[model samples]
Target chain A: MSARRGAGVALFVIPALLGACSEEERAAAAPAAPAAVASASGTLDLELRDSLEIGLELLEDGSLRARVRAPRGFAVAADGAELSGVGRLVELRESEGTLYTARFSGAPVGGGPCGAEPVSLALSLHRRGDNAFVAGSLTPYCGADRWHGRPARTPLRLTGELPALAAPR
Target chain B: MSPPHRAPLGLAGAALVASALASSPAAAQEKFALAVFHFNAQYVAGGTLGFTLLPDPELDLDDPTTEDRIVTESLDPVLELYERHPSWGVDIEMQAYLLDVLGERHPAVLDRLRRMAKSGQLDVVSFHYSDQLFIAYPEEDWLRSQALAAETFARWDVPLGRSVFCQEGQAGRGLAARMVTAGYRTLMWPKNLLSYQRSEFDTDPFPLYRLGDAWMVPGGRSMDVTAGSTNISVRWTFMDDGELLATNDMNPYFPELFRHDPASVAAYEAEVAALEADGYVVSTVDDYVTHLETRITPREAPPLLDGTWQPGSTRAVAKWLGGKGLWPEERDAHVRSLDAAARRELVAAETAATAAGLDARERLDSAWRLLFLAEVSDASGINPFRGEMEYGLAHATEALRIASDTLAEAREALGLAGLAVDPESDAVTLATGADPLRGAAVAEAPLAIEVHAGDRATDTSWELVATGHHRVAIRFGAGDERQLWVGFPGDAAAPLVTTLALADSTPVSFDRAGFDFEEFWMALPVGLLSVGTDRFVIKDQATAHLAARIERGSGDVVFEDQTAPIGETATWVFHVFEGSAVDAVALAGRVNSHRRIER
Candidate 1:
């Protein structure tokens, strides 16, 4: 479905960087195994209950691709923010070893968010060793919005369907 | 409360508890499982496979010559034999072995098995389609083989059970114990152990026993089967020790055991004679496997190993790849490569226009969708590539065009990434085979529809799904539906084909280890899509082209004939480069390249 919707866990969608080496690149990046998550920021904000962890593999080309797994929204922390307009954008930042950031918002489906005001929040990416984790939350305008049926330990492993990725194949 | 009232209440309570216990899901407790034989009457390897035994014992006395005769002789008769006799019971074993080989109870024997099972004599049957051995096949492919075979058999009026395995044939691979876990109980015939062991005074025709409920082959020497008994069919042994009915010269005595083995043969004969005196009656697999139990169930425990053995095949290797967990490093890297390929594809598509006015980009998108679906089905082992859907018609011509463009995009993308794109490759391959015969065969390998662009040019691409000599009906012009019987690789007696579609792209299906295409030239409806190194423009319906290279090694096909079209262009084309069997080699390596001391 939508790239923004997936496992509610912190998904580091930073483009993957390339370091040309012999098999050495693999050896170095080898230890950086893709794991679900290891840490959390704090208790999830009640408002960000259903926020998906939209994960992606950020390529060095600044192009992103997604492999998705839906989010299970039970154990993440979120702090609500005030919305400016219908197209309000929420900024996010992360630092496992390096800082990664993105801004997310809903589109005008039939119209816009159900409520007059939508909540947005800024997030920081965290990484312990080589593993990355998302630790922030955003609030959709509608109170009925939910991440998914189940809050998974790991966000949905999404492939293709990223915002920056090409339209559906 | 009165003592008498309490006692009555207690009794009722106990009864209620018993009922609950009965309904609770538990491993079935059975003494013997009836594993019948199951095979597709129309299984074709490389071309059309004749289910009937060829070189009829009465006529040719050898390999099947005519596909129809082989079907009639080997398959139809067995069912007819049972049908004529209302009292006889049938057991269908699984079909295995390549279509090219014969002489034993090979997969081609399914026609007879199905006919008999269809006649209402089937007692137990293997759930698998082609009798690919478990050792050689990946677990997922084995599951599909069983699923599609049993499901298809059911369509022919043969009731199918849910589980099966070549337990006896497997010496070390404990697939049967897992079969139980997978859900199957009564096996038609567990291999190995013979009928009637000769030890001193006690000459016992090894009675039917159970290894976790799966039945062993009918328990009696082929020579000892009592002609009057109908309880079990005492079969002769193969060179490898599997049992078979006596088709050779009779040896000695013991014809009387068949009557005493399972049921009285005299009773069966009387019923058969009675039926022939009348006409055909309706029957199926359900009646047989559940023949004994008063309470009938549609399924049983997993097939028991019971020490049966089938050959271990390597054809299932590709199927297994997707099932096992991939290292994160490998998976991510692969994804990266796939992305690059996809991007190049999009670019190539936009640059060109196909016959349908659909740009190369649009067709390429369709190709990618199909590949994605095939990759995700999770069939396991044998490169269990799966497909989501098979979009019907509309693309019949456009599909070929897309297939052509996609092939070039794949090569260009792969090459740019420094990936070695094989030298030989056709553009598009579409799915052009029937059921049982269907699946993601190389429908249209990478090939082009026409050499020159024109309205009269026949848009063509090729594919090779289930192998066999087939003549499927196809109309490649603008909106044509005149049905034709194109040849695919399937049994002429009974043909199975897959559906076609664009939105649901699952065209390129392959389980290398499965060797699904091991036979050729039967009454199968097949289509092929072709591609070339250079752009092709079609001028006429007849395209005179010659296939020079056909290799899986190159992941595409090779062909000759400069600008001239090859073969008769159809709705689809089947092309490829080159392919070779891959073998695993053991490697000797040091535990650590830096280590020197042995602690």
Candidate 2:
């Protein structure tokens, strides 16, 4: 019975893989297709709905490092640009071709509109070919009551792929 | 031999009865012993969540894989003991998290556990979903932990007994009411060394005690109290969880320690055989309770003291609070900040979800689960690793984010989006008309607040932030090194000062003309302070990690912010109302600006 179940699973998976391969082939044949970016050696930009962009770097060990540009009024809202932190890759799922979904939990870092209360960033992105679509939000902490006027999560979204830069050494 | 006649008798009478029973052969045969085995596998290598079977060479026994292996291996000896002595009943008190691991790694072990419980050989007990420090977090977190434990138990089809055990025996004065509210009938607290030393009741007889009312009825019987009422009582049974046995060169109570040691196991088996040979009925707490007679202690029995197993004193909880470098002041501040954030977000999210009639139950449950996991006591107590604290902070942050997002969605659904309250302007209404403390003779004065550190006293100026109706909000700057206190003018006579206990919210009062200042100070673990005559309720801002106490010298209630960072300002709301202290607490929760999300 176990062997029969294995065969049944194989029967279901083969066609799915072939269909995915066909989709990849058709995408490659398309005139306007952008080259697939290597999972290694490049940075991914996650832009939220509010146009707050977070830069993500996938490391050699499958962990992630993230950075966000500080907004005005933040203590570290420096002219120097970004605050960075190492994070753990919470989840990663791949579905044939270049399609994948990734979620990472970043360490709390100071900056943003939340001031000294370190804000943790959780980035979720769906990758298709060169661009990975991003949807992100920020929750203010220092004190819960301090964020009354602020939306529970300041929303962010990433629309299209940006040029990939060399990964941080 | 038939059981001896049981009656409720005073301490003297009970001592006399005990003496008489010691000489009686029939009573000698009625000796009962209960053995409880606690199993926990929350300690993971690198403080990561989840279970694994691959052992880390560095962590050795402390590794999650090894911990699970040890627990699984320890079950064999327990099962053998049950098989060797079928008539004997024992308890396997486990954390719900351990049960989850068992289901995942060793399903057969769970099957065996279920069989033993079903066959009446074992009673399955739990100490919340995870081993959370009940006194450190909010009451809502406690309730959610128990609810999650129940869900885990149901999923495994395990029969959870009526009794609950406190992890590390870290119980408090307020726990009894909370446990009663949570639908538990019996509590098996193995470490009552402090209670035993202070109380008149002798431990030799091991009489069953009741909480909410200070009385011990000599009986092997249990009584059911009205469920959900804070005043309800529960049976308290004390057990010797191997600490006593280890002193006598017997096997230790923790299974992982003794399971692999043949000599220790033999010694434990011999000890059990000796008890049996001595005519003692060794069984589970549930079974042991059925065989005892009732001997009531005095009506003026001492209240149940709060502490943990270690140190065996009322001040044991302070070990977790600070000192010994176990939990530093800085970590305490961070964890407390996260705790306040998670709590307020959860409350607001739930309230908004209800108002908007949103069916986001799954999201809310997830948020609560993360918060409860974050509040596990292991993160701060004992020899806590830095990784554990980080794990807690991460989970807490995620939980806060989920709850905050849920609140936003609920508000949007209710057509209340973009509605906001300026904390600076929206002051709560203060009560007027007459002084509620008129009969108590406590005179209201201006904000005469002082910051005290050692011998130095600094009179801090306050800013009246807002005033409305019966509420007045005052803000003052406090240094990390000093103690912040708010004073009221009163005579030398001490008025009744009452406040809800830290975690459980049971009404705790302090009112002795010259009570020991240290004792009075230790009692008020939470921030809210209410004076006599139902007059004034002084509450600090929800985020502050302040310990409030009635100053012995001046009769003033002081809120000490020991964990406040440098340059931090504390805001306190003074509420005047005519109601009980419990009502004042409820009103404080309702009227606090932090609790409101204006539309």
Candidate 3:
């Protein structure tokens, strides 16, 4: 029933953003021209602060909506963010060559170096040619603590090439 | 390992293996008959349009491209397949309009179909021409639409199936009641070919189980050659295999399998055989129902439920608009527009036309037929394939147009000009017999009349003014419109009425189009009969203003003025519109103790 769910896929939900803006405000916020992502298939895995790693698989279900997964523990990547657990990329659209906007959310288990903090990340990405970059404010508290109503976030940014990969299921 | 006197050890082991094989998950094969249910639906042009900006598909009967696909592609291939495999049956679902189109485009194919139908090699499935949801229609409207479909098939000498198939194979609450009343036995879910509801069809011990008074055949995985290469191969699961039916939309199937690949066909047959050998029996849905009827079960009946096409969420349809799909806000807006128009114009017009006597019956039916076709469930919204929804809106608008025209005709025939209730005068003016076309007929005779407005003003000696025979103007002060009554002098040879008391005061014809009037008197024996416009309003003056349909049984006709009170003389009252044959006869019959209009 929530806009965050669809056909067994854990849809991308920017809870804070969704709750903060009305439909009109969101429409107004949409960029007049979003950049385009290449027709080729690819993946973007970025290692962030405290060994945190995020992986995005460009999935094809007729059109390009990505399959996303996140790091385990609270702070950093443990065994590298595996492209497991399918999550939908929301607002995955391209406009005005080389400008695209999309949002992703994921919370996978097991982060060794980050000390199993059970982190959950929500990121908004912009793609320019082969290069796709995302910058988001991450909550320092683990997903477990957040579940108990603790809110903590630190600014984070990452840029990386989207290497070609087999399309994720 | 075993006693010599007993079965040999090897033989015993072999017997155990065979037994296990028979009951294993692989042994879980059920009998399934492959029945390709074909559907070729088109949007009714000029019906209600959807809220989408998609280009609407035009309904061009002369254009072979549209209906041709239904035949050359869909039906032709199936017939060819049937010719090769006589036992493989295909069911074609169609409504009257589609059949008519088929008749025009592919008569030979249709004739072949008739032969196949006769030989039990093909089946014809009947559905509302509009393919509308039963829930959307009123009781009479629903029944009439169903009957019309049945009649269309009967007239064509084709036998229709008792089982109903709707989009998504979903039925709403009270579906059972409607189905039973219409003499239907089952509602088949076509979507079962693609989606499965484990709790409903798979998990339940019996998939073909009864739901309250009606029988439901739920979800099953359906795949066809046209389903893309990914779905071409058949996958059988032991749990949901009960009563599995395979369908092939031949014309639309992948080109590789269009002619029935020998290897693929052999493989399909092998699969069916494998299932049957394991313990399954193959039969069509009808035969399966018959089989179920012969079996006795103790499971409780499932209650009827309502929602969208699917059981749980309606998002499946909305899902189609996802990704690059912008929500069809325009589709919703168009739907609202259609609804508002129908409520304000169509419904009232239909009711009025129905009560306007035999002449207006055909017009009313035409309007209803168009309206029904425009409201198809999928074409209205569930389907976003093209501009299908837009066509529905167009059809609805056209239906409203027809209804408006019919209402005008009825009103003109009834000789209704307008009624103005001046709440300050305590008296009401009932305008009638205005001929805007030919000018108001000048009256050469005098007539007595009784006028009453809410018991405050009652005049038994009101006379028709000869000079302005077409005009009748009276203002009422603080009088309710419903309480106003006018009694015409029945004894006069004929009282000529020609105009209304409007500012223009033009003589309005009784049967011409475009004459405007608020409402008019009904069952009043005004001795004159006027034929001016092809349309007019028909109002029944009694305890309250009644819609045309409602006044069918309520209007009272009396032979003499004041001979009996309106309520007391209800029996002689036949509420015929002014231009109706009965209107003239009934008025003449009761006037001057003679001269009754012949039936």
Candidate 4:
């Protein structure tokens, strides 16, 4: 997507704020990628100029789609999600690259969301044509932000004690 | 010809006056039909955990400064605050209802809003749930939040009929897709000043929003022989959906009295007067819907867009925070706070809802709603960061200053005044005497504030701001939307004004276009409302236009004394990157370059 002078909050997910805040001058879209997901929740500092976690919704065919995890929804970027067809949005929280899990309730766009109890499901991801997609057709069972390494990286399970790290600042 | 008919003329005039008053439009008074709807939700930016925050005040400490960190990544200070305060939801509404401070939760302080809606005193739109963080949660959470919000609104008499996030610049729109899915013909958001086609351009923080259908004229086409017609659902591809950035939300969101000084108040009122004069209506989301339905034809559409976050704003401030070399750990502390606060509220709201007769299903829905939208409110996460950094640690330790304060005085004042409520009260206090810090974080401080920058910070090509508290304004400018930060604090209860000092010239050219440079004074006293690192794009005019920084002016310049009410308070906070004093700063204001701005 095009990069503008954006800043504040998580610059990687919804890079739009930084683009909007850019006081320098206008320019074309810039190919900036989301940063790596930090496993430690106690203190992981980042900004607009930093990297962001790219969410992927893998498909049966092996193609990929991407989307930006905005403050509101999976704001679809030029990069689509890894999943295709009717896979649901899941929280792949994890701790230091340990047990990776997938939690899904419903697909993006249509249908109601997953039920309560942050469901946990086993899943994984792979890249395709510059895009990362989530792969799986599993039924969700939990709803909490199960994976906990970093709120940045997608398709992972949460594990660290992210009290203030994951709550509100 | 006058003596005999004088009585009749007086009667005729009286009748005319009465008729005019009668037809003055029921919206003239404080009619419920003319309400101001606002979405008070805490919104997270597009990034996730592990992302680095731009800059923070806490990092202005020792030798080396570190970069790339989240603003709310630490909680040691906040936890310490809890140890000091000990009472969380004591004198405020746990759910953040404004009335909580006045003590009304138990039986209900008669929930004036509910009363208003029931008694036809409001065209109000209630919240999705409690403390819902917008944009960060999963998609299902968004749906559950919407349904829960609808349910809550139903209980409050403000049904979740349409999507009404009439807050400053943030709202939980996880339901945007759902709303479209649910088939809302005319969804609305804040439409600041940008007016053009029926594109889904995000709205600025204007007081009101106008809605119209973008995809109209769906065809029920069959074999075009001779069959009649039938209505068919037609969803067209959204035309304008690239990136819309709008800025300049100072006056629209904050009240004039917020600044606790002078300059900011003047800027605020100038905008208000213009809006009032322009006949801009301060209607609620429902009314906005009605207006478009009535005024806008199927062929017409209002600027339609979502994504109510401004990036280009607070330029000077952001740079300032970004360059901190002092307290390196402050950034870490700040980011930790965000997460902690979110979790805190998450836990609190959930526990409370579950504790209060809410079923597992309802509790889940409400919890999701809180995370999805209500959490995005000032009563949620943003303000807590403000309490963390005071003008200087100026008073408390860097980590604890702005984040929390000593509430002994605040609680006493409120309690004595019969304004403070029990923490267990039905109200959810946003900024109260109990938790003076953390904004939505809730601390035991005497004063606290949260900024609702109106709709001025929505999608736009340029910057536009709503002049005052509750009005819409249009700005005629160029491209690359500027920045917008809400800082209005004082309202009609205490209006603010600005006074530009006349140069030490003779006779002082009365009402002249220009004057020599000397000093400018703007008054606002909302010290608590300041988001330290948030730089604002302040524009004020004067022929001599003073310097940029806002320090007390010691230089003596000539003055012109006139007999008009000059608004009290020069409470503007300017960012003078290089200037040593604000008295020496300059300006780029128009109309009121020297023209008196009154609110």
Candidate 5:
């Protein structure tokens, strides 16, 4: 093989620190957009076709945070063996009555020159009533960065409903 | 004894044959087994800072704060794992320097290691003290470094196993010959670097081959579990990539996170089950060697190669260093300086001690140990982290000085005269005496010397000849006040030369369009340089440009450095036979040399 000099070929095998550094943790913890509501209760389960389960929770402010749980045989896509961990943060604003637009900004996981770049996902949902809702699939958008040594292009689809929020006291 | 010669086959053919043999159905019934070996050498060549971004360090050897974590987190688990799994044997090759660190700070770990060795669970193989590249230094220096490594292992009461486990799986010229001399029975290098394609490993009939006196197992297609891969069913070997097992708690492979899939463990178990069912013998590298030794009679010894063993045609150091902006000259020069100093020191210490009737083994041994500690391989120095490069260089410099000082002390104790040759500064330091040395073999004759105009000995090459009495044959050149034999021959009782100075000769200068010299002996359209009884540096007169050597009879050989002429006057250096009939004009015409020097 010809020499690949300074071609951004990171010679580091430091895979553990990927997606889990102090700076990245702080960034992932911070919400991307300001919230409109005061608080929220209950979780929204975006059940997908594959035994992959994504639990989204509405915060006190109007923002959504996700926790991913992989099936018994499978693992989280990019983070190898990380079955449960914080996934993504998206802004939730009501577009019309019973309709909501979820806006998500990319968040970097690993911290370093050669760390894996962030991949973002967005979703749109329509509420039938207070107890049930229909949601569209979240499209994974990873700009020219690699995850798990492969291009992060694997598509994600949501097949389940968002659970009812606890009624405000 | 010479190694057996295997008919060299084209690489393409070798790869195809290997690939075909890998899938052969007959292998299922045959004794197809694997030896799984795990090695952990947590070292950064220069340091974390030198290779990586500053302050953002993955591993910093200079920092004591990190050592505790490395020991408790990275090393402790592996030790514990070995103790827990007695049936799963392992061979660990630790950097001798790191072993010392462990001995000092973590004595408990040493006790554990001793226990493991006692239980026949772990065997410590011979390795470079600093994890240095064997090819980087001269053969003599390399052997000394290896010897010192054994001494370091003794410090921890660790026994030297028969095999030599080196990084990158590449052996330089004649390494096997030296290894045999050093008492190694088997040598193993990684398999990937040996061939351009991974499939090439299939062609070999067996895992081990005889190279000269030592048995060598060039990297896989061996039915071994050392290759780390999920597709062991398809891949010939089971080699681990060395990164799967985490060195610290943060590694995802940590014991807590190990159960997440546990693919490697499952793979190992499955392989053992399958191979055992087929009546194959599963064993470690050492055990495998022992097994082969016991089964194979004298007539059935492994096929030997004609010369020293070479794992691969390409050197990882050459490739890596080329990419890092440091070429062979930079590395070679530094290595040459270290080697010369060491050679003089060892010879001086031994000779002086003998003259003074004092034991010098302890002092020489100390110097040897220091030299070994400073011998960093190609895998080192490329660490982009902070402090690694500086750390290595600092220690190497200190060690060289200690060796030099010890030699000086030996000379002083014996009241023996000495000459010190400083290759870097091109100066000689002399200690005068009543009698000057005679009949010493400084270099082989007929001698050849090439000294450039500058004080730097980077361009100097010489073969010494002992002229009767106190005089030694030396070539005089353009360099002014260039000292010769500042350091006398290593012989302690031999007479030392007081001083030998060579005057700068009138140099043949070049002034014209830019010009360049080629390899030691190869010709360009303009001219050629050849090596015979003497070295020659033939240049164009337009303006002496950068000079280089080229061999005769080969036009396709690769030239090391290629630079365009800067249109400046430059002088090239060369040395020819003392009484050759070929004059400057005749020599110039032969090689198209517009400017020539045979002196």
Candidate 6:
């Protein structure tokens, strides 16, 4: 399937994968990969819905890279765990000039964790003129057992904008 | 304004009285000893163990274990000492953070404190909401701290005393004016006499003097010796504290010290009893000030100097201001940037909220609280822990995020453009009618660029990256050891005015001062060289070590940015406009994109 078609397929498959089970249990279970994850190669300057700017790059190896450029102080996070400067994600899928979906798995940093299990983050970005609206959820799968029956899924709503690319100096 | 029937003691009479009191043991006994106990948890928000020699794993504001230990071990013994001596009035100076921690973790202890304060046995004094370096920040931040302290004290139903006490013992000439505006009547400064000698006080040791107007009194007579702008009458009394005596092996926080050493507690108790038995009135600072007002006359205060208690010099505060004491300059720079950005965003959020008519009281208060916590003095002061510095930066970043979110929502509600400028566009016209530079000049050519590495000058290059009607962006070449200096053609004799230098009422003239220089941070950003007809405002948005100097002989204002992280280009926006430098700074801030929401 084409990268665009694969991304569409992943969009339909994500909810079914999430299910009604708590995030910890689902996170403990292997993160289900889409039927065919799409990969597109290019760099796009994207702004979150709240006006946070991020530089997004899609690599040929089907990995996604997000870089925070402006607001020199901000740090990107995956599943509530702060990323060190740049965040790299796999199981990536993207539609040309339209949308993208990606998942990141990492051991949480800074905050206390019950276990060493890596949490999972599923994110989707829909591109518009100079803006990209995003929706995603972070699952504390690694430390799911420590939740003690508390909900572990954190929903994220981000509106992003893809401004006109700057001319090379 | 002189009171009737009160004799005005001239400078001679003050000196004579001081000499007589110094020689006479009987007169010395008549002097009142004001005892002020300073309590601090030494708490740094979001602090974690391992970075420093902290026994607790976390010193976070929300950590109950740390709060409980401080309340039970450090504070309870002190309160007990006060309780044992009901007739003794002592001043307790602390940050509102400790009070808040008491209210949350140990309410009973807080209640005891409230009762003591109600009965005037203990006077609760707060200089800031958090123990911040207020002089290092803008006056707005100082006001915010006062407001937050007021709110906290009101919530706890504790009396916030009229006297202000800086726990850090740092003071600037501008502090008295700010305190007067904040409704404070007295400043209990323990370090003043240390910075200024007895002779500086007209030979009267530890005399009560009215600040700003510079009046001092000796032996119940007032003398006005210097002129000041802050007409408001506020008094200052200097007392010797335990910290000062610690060099002589005296523990300042005796309650805490006595907790570990029982032998010392008995000795301290005996010393207190002896002091009372010797005809000395053990009084709080408030009572001492009241006594001074009623008994002693006012005299001309010595030159109000800027310093802290440590090092015992007027230049001591310079160590806290980008000096040697504030080490690891890179981390300090980053934290300073975060603090500046947070303050800017907070103002923007407030403005946006007002424009959108949003009732964002709770959210703004939270942001302000975080910002104040970020400004805590210990984070950047002498021997700061790495974890504490990062924690402070974290608070600043969180504050920025909260304020940015509020601003974004307000913009959305008001249907305003969120982006300050087109992110893609390098050039855009400003509505302020300020013209941008179309051409560039190198060192000693048309535009003078002076690059220095340590004491020697170095080679330099520059380019105009972007330009508009009101703004010009220049990117300077980077070198490993070079300090970048960019200058514009203007009158060297023109008055140089900086956002810092709060002591002087008039703009500093380079002609008079010869060479005037100041290191710029977000705390002190703008420097304008006004040439009567035209004004040149250098708005620094780069490193914290950016220094602006006005050379008397060269007839130019030079901006210096030290090389950091080596081989990184520094871009500065110079705005040439007709209006106030403040307006120019605001416009330049937009062009430089100072405000950004976090992702």
Winning candidate number (DockQ): 6
Lowest summed lDDT window (length 10), candidate 5 chain A: A88-97
Task: Identify the runs in model 5 with alpha carbons over 4 angstroms from their true place.
Answer: A1-169, B1-42, B45-52, B56-76, B79-84, B170-183, B193-204, B223-244, B247-280, B293-317, B320-363, B378-386, B410-599
Per-residue lDDT tens digits of candidate 1, residues B123-146?
334544443323321233344444
Residue B418, candidate 3: C-alpha displacement in angstroms: 5.2
For model 6, the chain A TM-score is 0.36
Mind giving the per-residue lDDT tens digits that candidate 4 earns over B291-373?
Answer: 33322233332322122322123111121211122222222112222222222223333333333333334323322332342
Q: Which one wins by DockQ: 3 or 6?
A: 6
TM-score versus the correct structure, for each prediction: 0.27, 0.60, 0.42, 0.29, 0.47, 0.60
The DockQ-based CAPRI class assigned to model 2 is incorrect
Model 5 per-residue lDDT tens digits across residues B191-266? 5433322233445334556655767665445553212211122123344423344331233112233222334444
State the lDDT of candidate 3 residue by residue for B424-503, as single tens digits: 23222343433221123334323333445453333122223222222222222332222333433221222222221110
What's the true lDDT of residue B154 in model 4? 46
Model 1 regions lying over 4 Å from their true place: A1-169, B1-67, B94-119, B154-157, B161-173, B177-183, B188-599
Collision count of model 3: 82
10 residues in a row with least lDDT, candidate 1 chain B: B583-592
Tell me the tens digit of each residue's lDDT in model 2 across B1-599: 11222222222223334433664533232354456666555543123221122333332232244445445455545656665776666777767877877887788777888877776677788858876665555556667788889889899988776555666665455665555555554555434433333433333233455555222333222233221211112222224332222223322223234345445556877777776565455566654443332322223224444445553342344333332233332343344445555665666677666656778677678677666666665545454444454445545555655665565566567575333322223332221322221122223433344444433324333322223114433444434553344444333354554443334344555454333333333323333455444555444333333334444455555544443334434344444454566765554554331354332
Scoring only the A-chain of each prediction against the true A-chain gives TM-scores of 0.27, 0.37, 0.34, 0.24, 0.40, 0.36
Model 3 bad stretches (over 4 Å): A1-169, B1-30, B34-38, B43-64, B137-141, B189-202, B219-282, B298-300, B308-313, B316-330, B336-340, B343-346, B383-386, B418-599
Ranked by lDDT, the better of candidates 2 and 3 is 2
Q: What is the lDDT of residue B150 in candidate 2?
A: 85
In model 2, what is the error at residue B73, expressed in angstroms?
6.0
lDDT score, candidate 3, position B170: 33
Which whole-number lDDT from 0 to 100 does residue A158 have in model 4? 15
